[model samples]
Target chain A: MKTLIIIRERDYVWLRTVFPDIHPLLFPICNKPFIEFLIDFSILSGSEAVRIVSDGSLIDVEEYCDNGSLWGTAISYSSIMSMDDQRAVIEKNRRFCSEEKILIISGLVFIQYDKLHDYKSLFASQPNGDLLVCNGGSLSLTGNPPKLQKNSAPLSLSLIALDSLDGYYRLCMEILGFASSPYVLPGYNNEAYCHIGRNVVISKSAEIRKPVMIGNNVQILEDSIIGPGSVIGSNVIIDRKSTVTESIVLANTYIGEQLEVQNKIAAGNMLIEPEGGICITMDDPHLLTGIKKSGSVRSLLRFLVHSFAALLLITLQLIPFLILSPILTIQGKWKKSKNIYYTGTAGETLTLTTTTIERRGFISSLAAALSLDRFTLLFSVLRGRLAVIGSSLELASDSNTTLHEVESWYHAGVFSYAEAEEWPVSGGDKAIVERYFSVHGNPFLDITMTIKAFFNRIHETNTP
Target chain B: MIFHVDGSTGKKLGIAALNGRLDAKNSSELLTSFERWQQQTNLIILDCSKLDLIDSSGLGAVVSCLRKAIEKNGDLKLANLSPKVAMVFELTKAKKLFSIFTDTGSALQSF
Candidate 1:
């Protein structure tokens, strides 16, 4: 079965006005994107394929769901005019619908469904018409129905128009206050009324009163209180001596020290009172601000310094780099490749040609020990395409995805900040420290970091 | 900000009528003077009815005064919190820590 999810731009216009940069699909009802609920409903209703049709850009949503393979379903996206009616939508997606049963889920609506019930069979057996309808959207059948008539009563589904900031706040409170989820929710089952994601640091003095959903990389500081009802998104920090009750704080937000957050939606620096649509972009960083990875200026500076240092090294080791290259190549121990890597926040992609001498024989071991494989990448610093000391340079592969997840320390560089700190680069704690310094550290600090990293690499190779 | 003590409620009660901005610059002064005010009496009423704006520092100082009064087993109550000041208190959850009244007279009378 195919599912057509239609959400017009007008449906989310009010939300955009209230909270700029918040994609309606990414709006959190309980630390879960509002669209996830719709997706869950489509999957439950036996959708083999789901296509999201929106007039607005679906890049953020697409980036998030990414073909829906995680849920074992095929997800595709399309764009349509905001004025496109039901028939026009069907006509446009008729190619996808083909001969299969198509379920058209329309509007930016919240559907209240029971997880235990067999909605798949119920939907399949229903007549060839609209199965359920509500104010926000409707669930309708677009193909032939099964032969048998299912003896099921019409389910009760209501559309709560999530148009205002107050309405959004009220919706969150209402959902949290409810005993059982009216819809299927993800995460652990035994933990009641909360779905906290990975890598959350809650200080011992911090108090959690339950019925809260906290996302990944969140820091609930000392003497702070969370919940009774709260939904905190990823990469958020609730600083010390503060309290948050009955509110939804979105991703990449920094809640400043000792401030109170009650009954509102805080996305980045903007505090939104959803009902009246009263939004204030806080000028005070101590109250609230946005959290982002460090920019390329630091990386570029490091690159320049490293390049000059690399030039000095090349001039000094010119005979060695030259003499070693032929011997290692002839012995089949030297390998070379070129790949594209993100240089910095400028979003410039650069192709770097690099050579790695295999770490086997005595000469190769000496080269590796002396960090000779990094020889060519150091020249990339001269080209202003790589950083000397910052984040580890990311290869455009699966590793890059993992690096992006770190939130704080994803800037790619030749020499990692973790290496400079002599901290194990793989762990979360080290990543936190490295990321903190990357954004906050100075150029003089970078020089020290690079020197430390160079010596640390020497130490690492000496040990093995 | 102007502050005067009402003595009719069997105890000296300081009514600090805050006006305009009470931010970082003035917050420390408010906190420092709170010590002298405590010497006069423990019962206090911050009449925020005239307060127009408050930042984190101002909120912190008010919370600190409440803590000091509570430690002495006396009390600090708020009266006639304007919509904006009430918002600051509500956001910080400071409203939960104090007894709020509609007017200074009622706060003093209750004490």
Candidate 2:
């Protein structure tokens, strides 16, 4: 049977106020996006194809679910008018709903179903009409109903309207309190009620009381207490001495040291008292802030180390640069151009004279191998303007130049870590390699990377 | 910040109504005015019903006012803390230090 899941904008408008960044359908319930539960139910009920119809933007959901190949089902997306009713949606998707029993699940509602039960046969046997519904939404059958044997027992089905924060919180708590066997919850559940995800670093001094679900890349710091009833999302850090009980700490949130978070929903810097729906965006970074990599001290140290390295390199390469640069220029092997390039800071540009060396003859190849082409840019390091080894030089006028996720930590340099690692010096993955070293590489490591990059540049046969 | 002496409960109480934001920009002003208000009466109630926002500096200034009041053997209480301001107090664990009330009348009567 085919399924059409219609989610109206008004049904999930409240979620926008709480989670501004997340789409309503992508809102996590028990560390799982709400739409995934619906998809799971459709798959269990023997849906060969599923189409998610929404009046709201389905970009995130589409990106996440894709063609539903992950779930072993064909999934499609369609747009609908805000005023579109059930019949209107069915009529719009007439081609998809043709020649089959279509299961219509509408609105922002939770379906309570167990995977152990054979819902496929039960749903196929049930008569077409409204099967189960709640205040917020309904589960109905449209098109044709399949004929079945008379011995089929009534399928246990129920719906809960997730229209308010209180209801949403209560539903999550209920699902969490119960063993997560009913729904497919993300994370590894080695023990009952304790589900953990990848790269979870729980400190030796920290306490983990059961009935908790933690997501990927979570750090429960020293003396931190997690659980009794807690759902921590991905990339969350519970700082030292912080106690999280009966709380849902969303992804990318940093719980401050010594803070007691009880019966709250923390999403980044905003903390919400779910029962009262009271929310407060914290202004202080120390208390309940977003977990972001801000390496000011490391950046300063890198600047000092790079400057010292640049000063040393300049001294050693001075005579070779002075002799080879003029000779290369006179030989028409060195091509120079003054252009603007993008700096680390947004909207900031740097004017630098870039030289391209044509490695045609012995003198030019010697100059290229000696890295005299990047000789003048060494001053930028001494001036504290660039790193010795960082991201690839991005041109300011290049409209196609977009920053990758890792490139946000990018510090443009004369030499890149990608060049040091012998990875592709330009492209998407190059930014990732550079960013990895930028975050992990210290001043000493940077010096080593710079040396490696310098030697690696000796073997370069391609034009810059 | 508007300060007035209230003796409705037959005891001298300084009621300071804080309006708008109490951040780094005007936190020192509150601290300076708090010293002058403390001279009139030590038992003070900070009415924060109109307080929309408060940063760390503002919280520090309020704590300092409480410290000065305690040095004079008096108490500084908070009243009608908005949810936003209360969240700051809770996050910083400053709520434990002050006796918070829902209204100014109750804060005054408690003294």
Candidate 3:
């Protein structure tokens, strides 16, 4: 049998109001995407193929579900009008539903089923008219009802209305409490109830209770207690002596020391009462707060170290610069320009007199080989303006100024961090590498990386 | 949250109905009043049916209450767990430590 699941945008409008950034299709119910539950139910119902009909964009859903090969079913998608009724939806999808018996599931409802039941046979044997349905949506036959040799035992389907935050929380908790074993949930299910993710650091003094789902990069500090139904998202920090129970903490949240977080949703300084749909954005970091990555000290240290390294380079290249300066000044193969560029942290703009070695002839080649073109900028590092190794400085303009204002993880450097790693200084992967080292690296390591960047720059052929 | 003392089975059991959330803000309140609640009886039944959410701190307070009750040769059992709240207990494996029941009457009788 084939399945056609129809969900209108109006059915899930509550999700957009509550979580503005989250795509409705990606809304997790009990750690599983809302769409995945429908898919699971369809597959269990012995669907040979499944098509999801939605009036809204399915980019996020499509990105996550991706052909549904993992579930051993061919999944497809269709679009319908937001005002389309059940009959209109079926009629629209008539081409797909023409050949076989189609199981039409509608609405934003959850279908609860026993994992032990063989739903394949149950769905196969049932007479096709409204086999199982709830108040939210229905299951009925589109094409001619199939003739079965034997009648199947009927299974019930209830509408789990997930229209409110309270419902969402309750639904998640309900599933976590009982459906843990039966459902394939995200995270690592090592022990019975605890499902942990990668790079979780639990201090020895920290106590963890079971039936918890902890996401990646979680740090449970000393004397803290966790779980008995806690869902901690990625990049969460539960500070010392604090406890978390029966709550869903969204990603990048820091729980303060000795605080309590029971039965609430904490998302980046916003405390949400899911049931009542009330949200309070915290102003204080100690209460509940977003993760602020301040690389000021590290950036300062990198600047100091880079400057010292630059001084050494300047010393080595001084003779070469002296030799090339007069000749290049005569040749015009050397060019100079003055522009204000961003300096790390202080947000101070420095007017840098940039000298470019033109890739014209043998004279320019000799000057480039000696690395003499970088002589002027080395003084700016001496003045503690830029890091010797970091990201290439982008001037602050209205178009790209939003980057700095939005906390760009990239640090402006005399020598790009990507150059040190020999990575192309663009693309998402390069950003990840630069950010990884920028947050974790120290001054000594910076010096070594700067040296590598210098040699890399030497190997790089200078182009326009 | 609601609290009442019951002695129907000849055992003094304090039943506390947790409502909404039992997180950091009010977990200490629960912990602080636990002694006073324990003074009435050692046996306790925490009805979490109305508790919509909990966090690590709230879980700690509950565990701490259990420890305090056990110290006095008393037992604390939970009843009517909301799926969400019960999930925390099961995830932390704290469910193993308590003698949980479906309702307050069963917990009271068990005590």
Candidate 4:
């Protein structure tokens, strides 16, 4: 059987106010995207193929789910108009729904189903029409219904409309209160009502009362209390003396020292009271704040370290650069170009003379091996404008000046983390590598990466 | 901010109605005004029914006011806290520092 999941934008309008960045379909319910649960149900109902139809932009959902090979199901995506009804959806996907019984799950609804039950047979036996529905959405079947054996037990199915924050919070808490066995919740569960992910660091003085679910890379500080009922997402830090009970702390949030977080949903710096549907974006860092990558002290220390390293490199390479550049330029082996590249800050650009050395003779090869091509950019490190090891230099132009890309800590550098890691120095994966190191790497680690990058550049046959 | 005396409590109860946003920009102003209000009456109730938003600095100022009230052998209670402002207090654990009431009458009576 095949499944078509139609999620209209209007259905999940309320969720946008709470989680603006996330698509409603991709909104996580217990660290798993809502669409994943629907996909799991579709697959369990014996669906060989699944297509997610949406009126809103499905770029994020498409990037995440992508053909659904990870779940062992062929997943596809299609666009629909906001006015498209159930009939229009089926009419549009006529080719897909032609040869088999098509299960049409529409709206922003949560289907409650037990994995232990034989839902495949139950769905096959049930007649086509609206099986279950709530205020926000419905679960209906279209096309043909498979024949079933006589005297089969009725399929037990229920739906919850996720229209408000209260509904969303209740759904999560309800799922968490019970054991996560009914749904495929993320993380490992050794015992009942407790699921934990990897790299969780709990302080010796901290206390954890069970009936809780914690995701990866979590740090519970000294005297902190977690649980009784809590769903802490990945990369969260509950600071010293903080107590988290009956709360859902989302990913990349830092609960400050001596804070009481009870019955709340905290995403980044935004603290939300699910019951009252009140959300406040905190302004103070000490109380509740987002765990961002950049820090003032860290940036200052990085600049000092990079400047010292650049000074040393300049001293060592000064004589070689002086001797080689004159000879190479005289011989037409060294090409120089004046170009303007983007600096670390927005609306800022740096004018620099870039050199491309032709590795033809022994002297030119020595120049290339010594990385004299990037010698001029080392001055940028001393000026505190660039890092010794960071992201590749992006030219200052309309195409390259993407505000989102430039806003990150991926500052222009003479030596890049991608070069050190031997990843592609350009394109999407390179941005990921650079961003990862920019967030995780310290000044001391950057020194090591710089050395690795310098050595890696020595072996390169082409110009950077 | 508007201050008025509550005669129903049969005590020198001061009810201060706070409206609009309380942030770093106006938190110090509130703190300065709170000192003058403290001189009128030791017992006070901060009615936050019209308060739409609050940040950490505003929370700090309120905590400071509570501290001053305690120093003067009196009390500072919160009343009619809007959900949004109440969320800030709860998140910062400032709600535990004061006697919070659902309405100004209750807070004045508690004096």
Candidate 5:
């Protein structure tokens, strides 16, 4: 048997809105990406090959699953259009679906099946048709069964569409609530209702109330309570005195000290009450923030390199700044404004004396070209308030938007990586560029990018 | 934020209706408004039906208002909290501090 998993974008549009960064197939359910479950089920059904078709960009999914060697299943990915019907999808991949009996799992639906059960025989015995149908999608079989068993017990399986946040939350809780989960969950499980993954540091004073699934590199701090029912994803920190009961904390999220996080889904700095469908992007880092992996050794080196680079830039531009500043101020060409900007740390803000030069002449242009406008900000680098090259900083203003939303990779930088990459300064484009640098950055690479940014500013076309 | 005194309960009870959001921007405004409402009636019930969202600062402001009401030898209660706003209260453990009711009518009677 072969499997064809058709995941239309329209089926999981809500997931894109809620988790824009995550691929629909890679959306984590109980700390394991959603795609893994489909692969497992496809393998369980005695499938020799699996082809996943999606309308959206499958680059992330392809990159993650990568030939399906991890699961030892021969998995292939294909693209389909929104208008494409089930027949069209099958026709498009007819070569792959030609020989074998095809098991078609369409839409974003969860298959409730016990791993302990034998599905191969049941699938072989069943007639070629849809096994079950749900509101979101269906599980149908194509091609004739080689030899049907005379009398086969009914397929004890159910399908549920993960359409809404409430449905998704309920599904996770339902799985956890099970005395023995039908689906295979990640992490190490020795006891019932408890799964702890690698490098989990649970403090002596911390309390574990059971029915908890903790992922890799978690730190349950002193006096913290984890789970009565909870899922803590990889690289999570439950700070001292914080209680996470009936909640889902996604990977790389920091739950700040003395906070009570009950009945919610925390992804990085954003908190969502799934039952109510209320999502809150927290501005205060002291409450909740994203934890980027920067070792103390790496951070110290970065700080030193940034400080040194800042000093070099200041020394090089000091003469030009002094020569042009007085003339610009006299000509009323230099405009200074005090704006509050978020610092490198989450929730911390710093006031910068920002200067904008009205470039009508050589002196002003020279000042701008030498990047004199950023001179005041250079001092902040030495003080460890800003990055040498990081995310583009936005003003923390009291605007109409309650979404004081900053991405997890956000860091106020002396020079934005977007400028260095010569990328457009729009929010979406800037985020993509900055996110790349945030992950791929090293102390040495930062200095090179800083130089590129400085040169890039010289070519910056002034409106005046 | 709008404050109203419910006289139907045969006691002095203030009902404050919070609007759209009570975040960092307008949290202090809620605190200031709550102070004035306290002078009229120490028994207060925050009607949060229309309050769609709140942040840490806003949660702090509400907690502070409850503290002030207690210091004045009276009590503050919560009523008609929307599910979204209620999640914040539950997450922060602030629900434990206040006597919550289904509606302002019930909250006023409780006072």
Candidate 6:
């Protein structure tokens, strides 16, 4: 049997609104990513291959679950339009679903099944129909059973709808409360109801209760109470005297000293009460904050490389800007406007003098080609106020929206990643492209993107 | 901020409607203004319906106001806290220090 998992964007939109940084498929459940559990189940249910299709961007998930070598299953990913029905989805992957019996898992759901169950034989005997059903999703089989050896037995499987934060919290707590967990969870489990990961430094003074799962590279500081029920993700630090019962501390988070963190989801600086789905991004670092992995030796090297590139561009553009800017000004072709934009710092704005060099005569086209309009911004790049290639500047008028969006690796730049890709400047896709490059970009890619952006600007200016 | 007296409940309840943000830039203003509002009637209702955001300092100012009201034998209550702002209070454990209501009218009645 082969498996096809089709999760639509609408099914996981709530996860996007709450946890924007994490893909819904990669959202952790019982210390394992939600997708991994599904994969594990698929492996058990006599599946040799699995295909995951979604309407949203699956690049991150693809990066994570690449070719499914870890599971020893051939896994592939595809994108579908939001309006596509199950029939359309099946039709799209006709070749994969044609030869063998297909086990279709639709929507955002968690399947509850025992690891010890003989699911391979169970699936072979089951008829071509929905094996398990819920409001959120269904597990349906297509094509014929493996053989006609008449078999009748009750199937022990249920679907848990991960529709709301409350549902998610309940599901996690239930998994933790189980005497023996149904699914294979990560970390080292020496005893029941307790799992700890690598490089975990637990203070001798700290008290750890039963029913807890701690991820890799975590530090439980002095006098801390870790659990009666708690799930701590990788690179987390539970500070001194803090009580963390019935809570989940997501990866790369710092819980401050003497704080009570009962029954909440702490992701970075955000503290969310899962029951009510209310969340807050704390500004004060002393209380709760993200332990960012940037500012490393690599980033410092990238900054130096960017500064060198900026200095070269300044040297190249200084002459053209001096020669043509005055000529354009004389002919009233150079238009200048002062706009306030959000700076790198929170609650700070920088006044930038933007220019529009109108195309008219030879000098005008020359000025646009040489990118004299961006001459002043190069200095800002050198001064470390902006990057050579990063996100497009967000206006101060839009600071309210920027305040929310600027949380994840946002930095203003002279040239945007959107320009390198030649995407339309005004759309959601542009932000995606810019953010992708900002987080994933290195000095080498930045140089290539900078060159691409420069020539793209020239091509755009010289179009008409 | 708009300060008014609601006496329909047979008590002088000062209702102050906070607007925009209450961060470090403007938190001190709230603290300075609360002193005058307390002189009129210490039993005050901070209507946070229009308020959008608050930082740690802003939270400090509100807590300070509550303390000042308690010292004067009067009480300060918060009402209509937006979910965003209320989450900050919940995270900081400051929710236990205030009598919070769902609406300004309920806060007035409580006073």
Off by over 4 Å in 4: A149-152, A293-464, B1-10
DockQ of each: 0.30, 0.53, 0.03, 0.59, 0.44, 0.37
Tens digit of lDDT per residue, candidate 1, span B1-111? 677888786677888887777788889888888888888778889888877778778888888989999999878899998765666666667778889998888888888
**Number of the top-ranking candidate, with TM-score as the measure:** 6
What lDDT tens digits, residue by residue, belong to model 3 across residues A85-144?
877887888888887878888877777766566877766666767655666566665565
Per residue, candidate 3 scores C-alpha lDDT tens digits across B4-41 of 99878886779988888887899999997888888888
- In the range A202-289, model 6's lDDT, one tens digit per residue, is 9999999989999999999999999989999999999998889899899999998777888899989988888887788887787899
Model 3: share of true interface contacts reproduced? 0.00
The model with the greatest DockQ is 4
Candidate 2 lDDT at B79 equals 98
Give, for candidate 6 chain A, the lowest lDDT window spanning 10 residues. A399-408
Worst 10 residues of 4 chain A by lDDT: A401-410
Candidate 1 residue lDDT tens string, A32-115: 788888888788888889999988778678878899998789999999887888888888887987798888888777777766
TM-score for each model: 0.60, 0.70, 0.52, 0.70, 0.72, 0.78
How much does candidate 4 score in TM-score? 0.70
| lDDT (tens digit, per residue) of candidate 5 on A206-242 | 9998889999999999999998899999999999999
Point out where model 6 deviates above 4 Å. Answer: A149-151, A199-204, A280-286, A289-302, A319-335, A340-351, A358-369, A383-442, A445-464, B1-111
For model 6, the docking class works out as acceptable
Candidate 1 chain A minimal-lDDT segment of 10 residues? A401-410
Clashing pairs in 2: none
Please provide, for model 6 over B1-111, each residue's C-alpha lDDT reduced to its tens digit, 9 standing for 90 to 100: 999998899998899999999988999999999999987999999999999988888989999999999999999999999988887776667899999999988888886
lDDT tens string, model 2, A295-403?
5796678788889998888998899999999998898999999988766744457899989999998899889988898999999988777787788787776563554
For model 4, residues A1-464, the per-residue Cα lDDT tens digits are 89999999898879876676678888888878899999999998999999999998786788789999999999999999999888998889889889888888899999998878787877787778878878888888777765763334576778999988888888888999874778888888888888899999999999988788999889999999998789898889999999999899988899999888999898888888888787888877888888854457877888899999999899988999999989999999899999887767444778878889898888888999899998988998899887888888878888767653335455888889999998998899998898788767899999999989989888788666
lDDT of 2 at A284: 76
lDDT of 2 at A4: 96
lDDT of each candidate versus the true structure? 0.76, 0.87, 0.76, 0.86, 0.85, 0.87
